[model samples]
Target: MDPVGYSHDEKGVSKEPQHVISEGDHGADTELRRLLSTRHLTMIALGSSIGMGLWLGSGESLSSGGPAGIFIGYVLAGSMIWSVSHSIGEMAVMYPLPSAFVQWTGKFVDPSAAFALGWAYWFSYCITIANELQGIVTVLSFWTDKVPVAAWITIFLVVIVLINVCAVSVFGEVEVIASSIKFGWIFVVIISMIVISAGGAPNHEAVGFRYWNSSPFTHGFKGFLNVLPTCIFAMSGSENSGLVAAETANPRKSVPRAIGSIWLRLSLFYLLGSLMVTINVSPYNPDIFGGSGTNASPFVIAYREAGLQPLAHIMNAVIFISVLSTGSISGYGGSRTTMGLAHLGMAPRQFARADKTGRPWLGLLVTLVLGGGLAYLNVNNSASNVFTWFSNLTSLFTLFGWGMICFSHIRMRYTWKLQGRDVAELPWKSWTYPYAAWWGLIWCMVLMVVEFYLAVWPLGKPSSAKTFFANYVSVIAILVLYFGARLYYRGPWWVDASTIDLDAHRRFYADKDPEAKKTGFKAKTSKTLGFIFN
Candidate 1:
């Protein structure tokens, strides 16, 4: 087989001139189309992060850690997410592909790490798919309790599956619209919060830092540390932009922009929103801990407390839309991760198959079955317990994924130096470099340790050993997969820096290639916005 030419398909037929499957060449011939635009990419990243977690789950964080604690936790977590995004963005733009960082782990570090991270990430998304589906039921119950939870879950599962099985363009467009709605709604809510805080509501009572001073820390520093898991879960999907890089148009330009905007989005929607919640809704408010469902959302509680019952209902509806958008994006992420795994020969070849529209039907179908089953299981459990279980399962996997991205970036830069590759040749680079990557890696490890401690010895609460294992099971499972891959594959513990393939499968365009030139106001505007945002 030619290293840079056509390779045999599963049928042993040389169908097309595809780059050989090697370091950077994994999934080079994937049928997934590059139909997503800059807007789609940006919205997907933004929409994925601003979901039910922000709307409803923040209540849990606020309840666990008081206003000051929650704010501090998000600031710390936001910085770590930013570092991870930069590290992943630099590599995704350089070699844009599905599950870019996962493949990079294999190329720059070790196949075992890639295998572990890929499966860990896939599992995380699948769990999120179920969590979001269950979330729909919880959100709907806010308006009425007439519908059975099982029916709601089934309906949502079908709708999400349909979206994932459609053309990639349809998914991109849906995400664009959904994400835009979420972005606009957040600003509206933030402004409303500001009004409420400043005595603009019917009650006309100013709530300036009252909650912060009265209950700055719940259960002291331990309570503040306890909320870290919820905060981490809220920020989990911010990196989905990199997963879409393979299917994004002008990814070298678009991906970096999408990744760069993460901090801004996090600050506006998460950090500032937390401030708004703390100001408008007291930590001691019973509604802040309204068990499960959308009723517990700080946005809803704050509005209702301000004597605006109608606005609370409206916010509850918006939470439903937010969760639906999240479910759709989770489906997309899970299917793509599955396809990436299959592309690397870790999963069955059929799992990598796609239809005419470049939709990964087989992988999507498999994910739907698993995710739907989990959602169905939740139908029998209390919504609060279901949310807690899923959240616990998902919390650690993201930290592990971020750790891998930072580690991989460190190794990639080392290899680039060893190969004498010019940094100027890179499309995007992380300004923070060694420090940013190291900071992300070390803190992620610290958070994981803290998470384990909270699981066993929760502050001001009691938990059993069984509960502890359940919470940390994903971590244990990934460890098993990592060592299992290492033993089975018996590849080098780490690839040599000089032997790393940095150039293969790069999406290069000639000066005369039709896409190389920009025309029209829309194109130029898009480019400018991407540059500014990224």
Candidate 2:
């Protein structure tokens, strides 16, 4: 299929074609509808990243790493995420393919790398769906245990599945709304924490740096190292914008703008939230480590500490919605990755079929059904433990997925230079040639090492075989996939730069597409938040 075609309206604004998917169209190359605008791209990217990772996982980080440890760990993770975004953002602008990085690695690096990373990334998000479903059950338990865990899982699973099966426009709108709510709630949490920190709450007790002074590092360096995996998990979904590049109407503008704003979200939402949580609540609070849901969230705990129980209830509700939103994103990412695998001939072709609305119905069904089935694992075992295990395993996949992304960027850049391509001719370029990508790649490697050490010698318990495999299983799976693909394809370990087809699937924004010239309320709103959405 050709790239999504656009036509200009009477007002000179770009409009998407209303072409419905043909019933006979079952090819892997069917083009997705370019209904997602710049605003949709920005909002969905933010929405996807600000889920259970920040709301619930931060509590685990606080318990293990103390206030200072979580803050510093997020800072480090934020930096690495910045690099990954730029690295992929630059490439997405050039290729603008569905599941951009998976295709990029195969095109610029090696087909085997793409096969391995594609499946690994798909599994990570698939497990994320299960994890978030479990998270929903845990958050609901904060209110009452009257509803059975399976009941809540079924309800939300159906809701998320509905969202995924609809048109990309509907998916984009739902994400935009969810992201707007999350964005507003984050500010409320931050402002309330500031007030509570300054002795402005009902108790009139100032929690000014008390936790930091008392226990900055709960277990010292080992504890700080322990927080890295949690940080990795929390920062995992920032790449969703790049994944939907094909569906985005103006990737040349929207992809970079969407990724360019990650730093702002990281600083304002993640880093600031981490700092506030550290100040407002003591890391020693038993609740910090008790639950795997909102009850343990630093934001909720902060409000509870400030004697604002009602707001804590509201926070829990918001986080519950946030988890569901994350589940929606997980389905979106996982299905697209499945479609990408099929397109690359790495998976069965039937999975690539899209429905009338350009929804990858077969892939979406597989992702949600399997993911929802996995959610049942919590019914018998401890929900919290299952959540933790799933999170740790996914984090390991995130490490490899992100590392390969940056590595692909490095290879792409070297190939571009070797081909004597003019940097100015490219639509977008990474912030720093090679350096940022290198930093991101090295950070992922270091975190994997940290994960390995923790897997062998956990913070307190005796190293067990279960713990080791739990952490390293994703790494082992990726290696197996890589080698399996290698044996089947028999391609070079690293793709030759000279032989790379840089022009294959590369999108050039010239006179044909007028999407960048769009004007409307959404574009104006984007301009108002220009610092981020520009």
lDDT of each: 0.79, 0.81
Residue lDDT tens for model 1, 1-534: 211232456855322243433222223567677777777888888888777677777887788788999899889989999899888888887667676777777767877888899988888888888888887887787678899888999998889988887788898888888887878887888898898889999999898888888998877889898778878888889878888888876666677678767877888888998889988887767756434334467888899889999988888888888888888888888888878777666777786777777788877887778888888877677766677777877879989989988998899888888899898877667788989899999999999999888888866567988778867888899999999998876745876676555766556532232333768996788667655453
Candidate 2's residue-wise lDDT over 1-534, tens digit each?
A: 111243455855333344322112222135566778888988877778787788888888888899999999999999998899998889887777677788788777777888899999988988999999988987887778999889999999999999988888899889888898988888898888899999999989997999899999999999999888888888888888888777876677688778867877998889998898899877767775344444467788888878999999999889988899999999999988887777677778776777767788878888899899999998997765786788889899898888988998988888989999988877887767688899999989988988899999988778999889976788889999999888887835776787665775566565433444658987667556763553
Residue 524, model 1: Cα distance from true site in angstroms: 9.0
TM-score for each predicted model, relative to the true structure: 0.91, 0.91
- Superposed by TM-score, candidate 2 places the C-alpha of residue 78 at a distance from the truth, in angstroms, of 0.3
TM-score of 2: 0.91
> Can you tell me which runs of candidate 1 are displaced by over 4 Å?
1-27, 289-295, 509-534
Instruction: Score residue 144 of candidate 1 by CA lDDT.
Output: 83
